[model samples]
Target chain A: MATDLMSNGNRPSAEDIAARRKVIEVDRLDFAFGARQVLFDISLDVREGEIMVVMGGSGSGKTTLLRHLVGLMPPQPGKVKLLDKDMGALNRRQLLDLKRRIGVAFQFGALFSSLTVAENVKLPLRELTDLEERTMDIMANMKLEVCNLSGFGHLMPADLSGGMMKRASIARAIVMDPKLVFLDEPSSGLDPAVSSALDDLILKLRDAMDISVVVVSHDIESAFKIADRITILDKGRILISDRVDAVRNSPNERVQNLLHRRSEQIDVDPTEYLRRLAGD
Target chain B: MANPAKFFEQIGRRTASGLDEMGYATVLFFEAIYWTLTGWRQRQPVRIAATFAAMVEIGVAALPIATLLAATIGLMLAIQSLYSLGIFGAEQYAFIGIALSVVREFSPMIMGILIAGRSGSAIAARLATMNINQEIDALQVMGINPNRFLVAPVLIALVVMMPCLAMWANIVSILAAGLYVSAELNQSFGAYLNDTLDVLKVDDVWHGLGKAGLFGIIIALVGVVNGSMVKGGAEGVGRVTTRSVVLSVTLIVVADMIFAYLTTR
Candidate 1:
């Protein structure tokens, strides 16, 4: 049962999985904003055609780690290699070229408000390809259709509901047919049913597109549903990186607290509490 | 009392940050210029449609207010100059003074200030909102340079439109002053117009247009710099919008003063 769950009954053997290419590799990455450290000694990887979910509570630096993977923030005191190319070592032109082979869907669906939904999806194509206008339009509509957003291309992003907007954002992310895709909080702010649907969509996307996916999320249910492997973070440090079943049965008290949705118990000192209340 | 070391440290930090901002703005300005010239060669050509839309937004939309303000300045110039020159019984020469000042100085300066408040604030707010939404970051991830895709078209449009608006202001202001002075002197409007034309040199018109272009560059660079540097979300956008306007206006005035000093010397 554990093997079936881990391999999804159809995936390659353990040896084959181990031999698969690493689409994303992070080694001892650390990040800081001013004097405040956000990510500490983080190391993880996403194998080709696998869905890797990086999950954590709020302020655990999940988003910060995702940013480093996408090359939005440089890895300080460490290295991030995407598709075997070192992110920190790439020049501007090299980085741009590398970026073309990956897609990132931001948490908030970050579509350009001024453009129509179709135009928003087509932006990368328009900016990076010299394709004919008609061809670009067709390609954009096709991607939108894949996200179940067909026939809604003419509307502005402002006109779409939250779900439709997120779907459209995913369409834009995959418009370039990238080998790797990063989704920031893909199921955030959705109803349970909708969230489940999004998880299914992600799994379907990875299988159909043959692309590796990195999802930064706090939604444990969605992560369990879609993630082949999960990396749980706490306070800017990785607590567990393993298969879903192993993570579920882990003996770590913090892991159990997170997995069971148990609220953290804090033994607040009376003097500190009083001082905090008094604004001292 | 402030600790001397702390005070010095604060000053040093501020000066360093200020210099860093100036350097970034300088690079952004030159990059905009470079992209404006060469962006067409890229996979995504420089968007002429976007540039035209910005021209309509920054220039055509401001036309009515600019004309009204120019006419008011002209009327005020006529009244005040006439009063002063009237003491010397030289009120008849007020048109010459108005023509020289409006054509060479006031028109461009007033238009620059107006644009700083109007379009400069708008540019800053728009870009800052985009930044807050992560649209700029999204653009970078998509291999689209925001400077090429967003800033260059706006810079090009403003540089083209500012001189055009300034020329219109010059005409309107001079005409307003002409009509007022002709009626006051009980002379024909045609005679006053002729006097004005006679006093104004082509050099003065070109000088004002040149200043208008410089002010356009200042406003665009300031807005882009402030917008791109915004943090802390919506409040940050509002803060940068105000800063863009204030900084553009102050810089325009200072640049005008420097130009005046250089030309007169």
Candidate 2:
């Protein structure tokens, strides 16, 4: 199935994105785990009011990159700038202030099990603002309504299904009306209907709230459905980042392999295989 | 055979890692202290409700077991002390032996070990599970310091509760010993209690309570540090939980020894 960026025509081109403000910018980011390198010379940008999907197969460093964008892991030997603040240079107070401007929904719900769903949604507000408890409750209810989780607030996270948990997590992420939201694997481990609903929520969030979103996902269909721009990561490097049609029509073999769900068959030498089997 | 140099290298690595972890725990301990003092200044004051919740979990919930164990220990101490003092034909001083030992050392040590195994392991497991589930990360992303929001309340609760539990144990154990001694000597329980109180100075009780407080800090710091450093997944939670209890118990004993020596000297 082929989708056309040009025919849709309302989609912004690369030049159009350049004119918009960049909410998040990563420059030459490199990350490593002890002796092993996981992210290499990675550079990407999320513009204002755009849903940027970073897609890759397992272990492709998409989650690592998301962590950097959300300021969970400081970028080493590189830079990550969010809302025009250098993440690595910020002091404690400054870092907290910066964090308040963005929100992150982890892959799993990550709701505090001790708290009810509404309490989880209101936690950031409660921690960051001295608003009256009544006001905070109303605000939490509004966000929950926005995420289509209006009455489920009284239930514990353990009581919610996978999809409801993800929605509640998103509600919490956006409750503070953060300028940017980072969602990690929102559609993962959900039925297609639920995943589609999450995708619709992402779209609604961007269009209605005017918030930029960075989603780390390997789901090709959901990525294409909601992402204004897509960055394809393979083995710690960006293979291609472009409009959805450009990504779809790209000549890159790995991108095609991912899009087509084709697994690459690695050819092995018989002698090497036998020798390795024999513990040579 | 493993190379001799590799063995030394392994030892060196382990030593360095151990020191590194201790250093981290020290830093976190100080951070918890700082947050506990200034947490009220927060835009959203760290809720007293959390502290009370922790008190319930770390302190109130363990009351029954503490009572049962301390009573049994009191009986055992009385039986042993009476037999030893019987040879001198001074069974009348049996209350003094039981009271001094119970108030000065045994009560605090037992309370510490109990809390370390029960609450300390629980703290480590809860925090590790939070870490694994990314709830800790969620808090950080929400501009809340986990040290302030999570660790400080637990630290305060434990520091407050350990002494209370220890003091309660002291009373329970002394009373149990008094009952046994009164029954043995055909003396009134009230007379036995009076003699125990007269012999046991305020300083002795304070010394035990002080050790209990120190053990509280040890348990809190060790549990928080171990929980925060958890890696991987479910197995990591189990490992940290075990490590927290073991380390807290070990450090409590070590600290008790030092405190005993210094206070006595």
Which prediction has the highest lDDT against the true structure?
2
Per-model tally of clashing residue pairs: 0, 0
For model 2, residues A1-280, the per-residue Cα lDDT tens digits are 3452122223467787778998888999999999989999999888988888899988999988888888889888999999999999999889989899998898998999999999999999988988899999999999999999999999999999999999999999998999999999999999998998888888888878889889899788888888778999998999999888789889988899898887664346778878988999
Fnat of all models, as shown: 0.92, 0.95
In model 2, where do residues sit more than 4 Å from their true spots?
A1-15, A266-280, B42-44
How well is each residue in B111-137 modelled by candidate 2, as lDDT tens digits? 999999999999999999999999999
Each candidate's iRMS in angstroms? 1.1, 1.1
C-alpha lDDT score of every prediction, in listed order:
0.89, 0.90
Clash pairs, candidate 1, are: none
DockQ of 2: 0.82
Model 1 per-residue lDDT tens digits across residues B1-265? 9899999999999999889989998898888877777777655567888889999999999999999999999999999999999999999999888998998889999999999999999999999999999999999888888998889888988899999999999999999998899899999999998888888888889999999999999999999999989989889999999999999999999999998788756
> DockQ of candidates 1 onward, in order?
0.81, 0.82
Q: Which CAPRI category fits model 2?
A: high
